[model samples]
Target: MKVAYWPGCVSRGFTPELHGSMALVGPRLDLEMVELNRANCCGAGVIAEHNQELVDTLNARTFALAQQTGASMMNICSTCQGAQSECQQRLDADDAYREHINTHLEPEGLRYEKGGDWSNKNLLWLLVEEIGLDKLRERVVRPLDGLRVAPFYGCYIVRPTGRLGYDRFPHRDKYLEHVIETVGGTAVEYAGSHKCCGFPVITMAKATSLRQAGRHLADAIDADADCLVTPCPLCHLNLDLQQPDAAKYVERDLNIPVLHLPQMLGLAFGLDPKELGMDKHVVKTRDVQRKVAELAAA
Candidate 1:
């Protein structure tokens, strides 16, 4: 089972280990991962908000690359997966956008396939469906030992409502929570778990973004969560890097450490701090690492 891996821009820079974690665990789950050697940015929020042509082109090019591999594509970022899946949906429905994109690529002899939803899978969907909670259970060498996590969805993972295409999952925070529990960690529910992280507003108005991020941070911190974990890179960026600023601006100590979903899952499997790249993150997950070590020692 080989699949094309799309790391997107943020994961390439900010959450580098996510791909590494996937590489480490992919084979264990019977997946052979092949990264798109020529992949570029998924246009983040640019093409979607600004140029429809480029959005079509960006997603089409990625599908073209995946076709080059003769394999389906799986993405690590919630934003990228959402973008690609959205583009796929649009291409699947509208013939005009599809032909326009394929024409742009025709100079290079590339084209989007007809009558096909470009094969794309989000990690959340893959983990729940492909990995199976039962299989995830057998691999838990290290239990989270009661460190509570606030299951933060923050929009992208479960959007357009019905695209996830699975049973009774209802496209909610419960999917990631279920996976988290299999690794022995409790997914704490809170008020702001489904709210936006103010990622789009961050660039235009810093205050609005900080206010929104702080509100979410306060909820997780107020819940006494040891960490805030989510699958979106933008959410990780906003919640982790912006919290200190948001805290001061909001006049409260959020002091909450943020973890990428993969980072937390890696820890739950006893992968250790170095292997998980905990020290390199903006939040410096070292304290969480120390807590785990101390608890393990006792």
Candidate 2:
């Protein structure tokens, strides 16, 4: 199962372990993860608001690189997945836009044709749809038996409607839960699971963003969850990096640890939490690690 892997901007610099854990866990799942050398930021789904053309050209080139690999483009970040997938869909449907994009690509010795034999696939979809839950369960040597996980989908991953193929029913909210249970963790449903982590509004309205992230954490805490797990890097930033701010706004101590989906998966695959970058989190993960240790004993 070879695919061109794009960690996007945030995961490369902010949460590198997301990709690192994937690299470690890929072979266990027979996943051949190939990095995209020519890929740039998928505009983080923000540049489109200011310059749609730049976003389109930027993503078209990324798809072009994935095309070279003769495999689908696999994205770790939800915003990157949505942005690039949206661009691919537009390029395939719009001829004039495709010509315009190709004109820009021509200078760099790259060409994009409509209805090309390439596509973008989200990493979560690759796991659930392609890899299968039973297969993933088989690799879980360290089952998260006693841990209670709150699955946060954030926004853009299963949203904005009518874009990605994974937007179908039964998966929009349940995919994360399925992955959690596959690793032997109990999935807790809270108000935060389907809510936005408030990354998009972080720059423009910092306070509002913090409050939103705060509410999500509060919900998870209220539900007595052990940790929060998400596939989106921005969500992890809000839920983990900005946790102090979220605590301030919510007027409570929101101390729950947040983990990248891969980090949780890595732990279940029997990799050390430190190796998966768990110790690097703003919120302490030692308790969660200890809990896993306790589960091992039980």
Candidate 3:
């Protein structure tokens, strides 16, 4: 019931609503989430690709903070989960890397006491495992009756099961849809739900990111989804923020609303539009908000 949550850099800044909504929604589902006092980046940004040592040291800081809670850690960012997920395999297989990581933390007097390595959990797993479907079903204030949601998995979040085991349960749509159902929403079956969302190719080349994103969007739109949702902020960036650029590259316009799973859940929990931070996104949530209001009224 008690767990620590790590909201990676983007979630802290651009996706405040998702984080805020998690705090609001988790407790209602009987999860007592303890946020790390000084939750920092999980050493993901460019460190993971360029420097292994820096990645370890940087992430050790987050581990150090989560260990402070003395409870299992639940994570919001898929990339952060991937980093921590990756370290799980290292800490288990290579004592040298693990010890060196801990040694780096010694100067700060922070020790990595491993009864087990960080219990890196994704929000979906936490809901399915920690809070059962029955409890989820009990929380529905507004059901997504007519809405068909497209679940986007992207990549890092679901691969390499060293963390949330999302790979084992590789259906991103179902989890969001489950919560959607709890609030009376229909989790519409759709194609492109498990596509990569172009995370790897995004920053490497604009063309690559564009083509990949446009294709993914085009597929989702073609599937007749009312809205697209994802747990990963990076995926949200590509699928939501970069859609305009992607559309230009593909030479087509897509007005599809990309919803962060928590943002949708927060609205169902009766959170105000401001509390969900719906305005900060590239695509407006006004129509989505109207639908929710209509659903609740109905």
Candidate 4:
């Protein structure tokens, strides 16, 4: 399936492993990613606080770029997916609003036309909807049989059901668990799986963000999960990159490995850990790697 792939700022900059892992695994799944290189940021809901119109205009331009590719839009970042989807919903519903946004695009000769077959979805949605779980299971060369993986669905991807397609995909909440099971990993159900990783408020409330991250990590550990997998790079940034700081806040040694969803799939596809950028994570994935390796060797 061909898609106008939008590697959001977080994946492209903050967590390159997430982006790299997707690059390595996308072709294996026959997902042709036509990157929207010229596209600008989706604002990730941060910019919207100051200027909602500006955010919509920026996203409309991105949609226009995706339209030029003549393929459906796909985002790796949950923040980007939510921001774009929200804007797309507005544009689709309000004709006058879309026309007003198009005026800004006129300078660049780009206009986003709604009511087409074109759609916007995140990588998780693509894996479950476009590439069926049954098909994905068949492609697993290295089954994660002994691994207990926890699924973390950060706010944007699953919430606001109307924009994120949760209403249409009623069982979408379990999609991550299905993928984990398909890869032969035990899905560890935890309370923090669907909560925020606190990335949105990190800049303003660092301590609160760290506490939230610590809570999620502790929840996963308490649930006996070997590792946590998240579709959102921002969540990974907080859960993995800031884990040590979070430990200080929570008063515990939280060393759980957080994997980007693609990295988990890459491992199941028999791709090397280094190839999937697993070694680059802040919270070392060595334990998860060794466990998977031992299981594969058995």
Candidate 5:
């Protein structure tokens, strides 16, 4: 299937591995990821607080760009998905507001018509709903047998059900768990699986952010999970990149490796760890790699 892929700012900059892994996995799953290279940022919710109109305009511009592709828009970042989806929902409901936003795009020759032929869905939704578990299972050349994976949903992707679709399909709450099992990995149940990773408040309250990140890591560790996988790059930043600082806040050495959703899928698809950018992670993924390798060899 063809999709207008929105890599988002974080995936392109902060977490290039997520983008790289997605590139490697998309073709393997028969997905044509036509990147919206000219697309701008989704405001990531920060801009919405300062200027709602600006956020709406920016997202509307992106939607206009996606419309030209003649395919449904798909985001790899949860923040981008939430921000754009929220704006799209509002624009679709209020015709006058959408027209106001379109005025800003008129100069660029772009128009985002509400209730158009295109819709938006994040990578997680596409994987579970569009691709199907049976199709994913068939593509798993190297099953992650004996590996325990903790699913970290973070926020944005699952909440505000009206915009993100949890109200229509409650089963989406278990998408990460289902994907884990499809790749032959045991889904480790933990309290922090659906909780926020504290990325939003990291700048405003450093200590609180650290505590939240540490607690999530601790919960996954306490559950005996081999590694934690998250769909949001911001969550991965808090849980993986900031883990050392978070360990100081919680008074424990929290060194659990955090993998992006695509990276985990790439591993199961028999892709190399380096190709998936596993070595670039702050918390080393060697343990997870070793476990998967041993299982595949056996």
Candidate 6:
């Protein structure tokens, strides 16, 4: 399966490792990812809070790129997926808005068709539906047998169907767990699996965001999860980068390591941790790597 990849702004700027790991893992799964050329940010969710029209125009350009690529555009970041996909739906449904966006695209020789034959897929959804869990299992050279990974599906990626978008078919909450099991790891249940990681409010409400993230970490610790895995780079940031603050907020030393989904899958694919850029994480992946080695030995 081939798709155009949009790594999004934050992942390109703050989490290049996510892209690195995906590039490594995709070939193993028979998934060919071509990075979308001249693609821009898909509003990052925060932009809509300030300017809705700007968000629509910017994301319409992104869709035009996907349309030009001839394959559906795939996003590694949850916010980018949500923003662009929601914008696509909006532009398709609203005639006046579509015309307005097209007027902006006309100068660049790009025109977004209201009935455009393209899709904006999230990586998690692409893996589960397109690649199939059995195919993913077949690519697992080193099964992560005995590892308990807690799946974290941060806020924006999964919802607002009742608000602004459509419901994710086949249920999105199970996508992470499916990928975890496909790589031979146990997906442990935790309260924060479906809760927000508090990333969206991090800028405006730092204390509240830390407390919320702390609550999720506390849940994961209680569940005895070895580490947390997330599809969203922003969620990874909140749970991984803000871990220190979260520990202070909860008044406990939460030593849990966080892994981007691709990084965790790379370990199962028998790729080197260094190649996956595991060391760049705020929370170390050394322990996770050590555990994977032991699992391979067993």
Candidate 3 local distance difference test against the native: 0.72
User: Per-residue alpha-carbon lDDT of model 1 for 1-298, expressed as tens digits?
Assistant: 6888877777777667666676666665677888887877777666788987788787898888888787778887878877776777777778887887899888877777855444677666778866677887787777887878887775766776665443446644578788778878878877888788888788899898888889988888788888878888788888887878888767897778888777777776777767776776666676688877875676
lDDT of 6 by residue, 203-260 (tens): 8998889888988888998999999998899988889989998889888888788899
True-structure lDDT of candidate 6 = 0.83
By summed lDDT, the worst window of 10 consecutive residues in model 6 runs over 161-170
lDDT of 5: 0.91
Of 1 and 4, the candidate ahead on lDDT is: 4
Better of 1 and 2 by TM-score: 2
TM-score attained by model 1 = 0.92
Off by over 4 Å in 2: 113-117, 166-170
Per-residue lDDT of model 2, residues 1-298, tens digit only: 8988887888778888787887787788898888996688898777877788888898888877777788877888888877777787788788888989878888887776555446576767778888899999999999999799999986777776677664454465578999999999999988879888888888899889999999999999899899999989989998899999888988999899999988998899888888888888999999999998777767
Sorting all predicted structures by lDDT, with the top scorer first, yields 5, 4, 2, 6, 1, 3
TM-score of each: 0.92, 0.95, 0.89, 0.98, 0.98, 0.95
Indicate the worst ten consecutive residues by lDDT in candidate 2.
164-173
- Lowest-sum lDDT 10-residue window in model 4: 158-167
Error of 3 at 125 (Å): 1.2
Model 4 lDDT tens row, 1-298: 9999999888889899999999999998898999999999988888888798999999999999999999999888878888888888888889999999999999999999997689988888888898888889889999999799999988988788877777789987788998999999999988898899988888899999999999989999999999999999999999998999999999999999999999999999999999899989999999999998897888
- After superposition, the stretches of candidate 5 with alpha carbons farther than 4 Å from their true spots are none
Error of 6 at 196 (Å): 1.0
